[model samples]
Target: MKILVTGANGFIGSNFCKFLVSQQIFPRVFIRKNCDMSLFKQLVPEWKQLEYVYGDLRDKSSIRPAVRGVEYIFHIAGTIKGSSWIEFYEGNCLGTLNLIKICEEENPDIKRLVFTSSMVAGGPGTPESPQCEDTPSKPLENDWYGISKYYTECCSKKQTNKLPIVIIRPPMVIGPGDKISFDLFNIAKIGIKVFVSGTPRQFSMVHVEDLVKGIFLCGTHPKAIGETFNFAYDGTISYRDLHEVIATKLFHRKYGNLIPIPIPPPLFYFVGLILELVSKISHEPPFLNRPKAIQASASGQTMSNQKAKQILGWKPKFSKISALEHAGRWYQQQKWL
Candidate 1:
């Protein structure tokens, strides 16, 4: 089967490529010219089978050739952070719209186009109630990243009749090769654990391996077409619990001595505002901006994976503790910790 995976060099995309190659399926990978190939290079023999197509999601002309003769399209590329709303829209919204247009106009042989959206698009659910597939999205206007994804989903729906579209909205994805979680682990290693203030915020997360499995299932399963699913573990975890898990795995029982500090909601917003101001001059988006801080401080951004389980016959293979340990071990092995 000839498949095309955009953002093939990214964390989730690279993992998905590894999974496909392991199944004896060498996918045609679409990536930007400057994307790091070190991860794919490490695959050695298997990497040779991958067909590389250099392209940018924002460029329709570049995307055209990448979609040609492909049976499956995994649209996994999008900007997570940007200096402005325009950057987010261009990368996430326009990029997605361009791909859908190409597939609709040119790729008659395309069997499935799996779009990797995010839980941010669906709006965060509370601890008592997790968001499901049917939950209506309520993204804030200022939340450019989330709004961009929401727009991408909208674009996907426009081509549902012409293309078999499957949208996978995954919550906080954690596992090997994940840098965000690695940052958390590093913070814990320093003996200071930070928590957001207000009502305790909880999150739903899935290991990258399990998430890619769900993506594959969405691509292959008949019932998944024209459907949207949230991929996450069965339960949710508080921020404090997440830190404790990482600290325990990194330092074992000695994590009990780590100091826990809570940042008030207003302070988070203030810091975000300051970062946003600095970004205007630097022209580079800071890791933590005002909108992100607001999101971090918000309570209960969890989701249910019941739809994925029932529709695609999928469930996470790793528990939270086991998954964190797996990620920590990978980081240590790579000397990233």
Candidate 2:
């Protein structure tokens, strides 16, 4: 089937494209003007199969040709590490709206739109309560990423009454080509023992390969229409346990020496606010006081993939250990470490 994948040069999108090619399905890629295409070059040799169109999702005119004759649309483009909420809104929310408009006007035949969303949309501040698809998006204050994704889903649902829309909420996807997990790997390499709140919060995670498989299934599976699926691992692991897995795989170290410090949640917020204020003026990502840390340590962010497994016949093959091993090997190949 001919498909159109937006943000095809990014970590998850590029990996998804590679996975499609392995299955002998080379979808057309819609890349932004400034996105680096080096990753695409390294992965696919026969570039002819991977048709790329230079377009910005925020501009409806540029996106029209890309959707022509496309059977499915994997709308995955968005800005994550932004310095301001405006960037997140324009890049993610408005961009998604423009894509929906293009699909409505240019390609009415496109029957499926598989949107990739984050688990943060459900707000990852409480670990005790596991979030499901029906939960309202109680996004934390200043959580632009979560808010933007939530609005994207809302806009897509409003536009597509006849077409099928499947939203996949993936939690902390880690694999061979991810930059977010690379930070953890780098920290582990330095023998810097990672520390977290003593409160054992669960981290719902999935391998990139497994997430891509879930997306492909959602694009074609009849039961997936008008549904939101949490494509996380079947089981949830503690933050400390996750760190230990990373250390063991990358550094070959035992789980000891990892520090677990218990700090009040309010204190973390105060410090984060201070850092954010400074970052706002400096135009930089806060190094020490990012809000993501509080969510990571205090929030459970645990989700059950039972629905996906039972409905879509999706099973995640890579365990946390396997994911780390593969990530380490990929880092070595790229000389990232």
Best by lDDT: 1
Give the Å shift of residue 4 in candidate 1. Answer: 0.3
Report every candidate's CA lDDT. Answer: 0.83, 0.77
**Deviating ranges (above 4 Å) for candidate 1:** 43-45, 254-256, 270-287
Put down candidate 2 lDDT per residue, 1-337, tens digits, no spaces.
9999998888888889888998899899999777677766676565576788998987888999999999999988887766567888998898888887778788877779998888877776344567777777776666677788888877777765766788889888877667666766776666554445465777787888889999999999999889989888756777567667777777788775555444556666566668668867975445435446556544577776778988999988887678768877888789998
TM-score of each: 0.93, 0.89
For candidate 2, report its TM-score: 0.89
Query: What's the lDDT for residue 53 in model 1?
Result: 89
Per-residue lDDT of model 1, residues 1-337, tens digit only? 8899998877788899989988989999889997777766664348877788898877889988999999999989888876578988998999899898887778966899999999888876876888888878876557788888988888788888888999999888877667556767887777777778656788888899999999999999999999999988877888777777888887774645668888897897687778778867976445466656766776668898888888789978899779888988888899988
Worst 10 residues of 1 by lDDT: 283-292
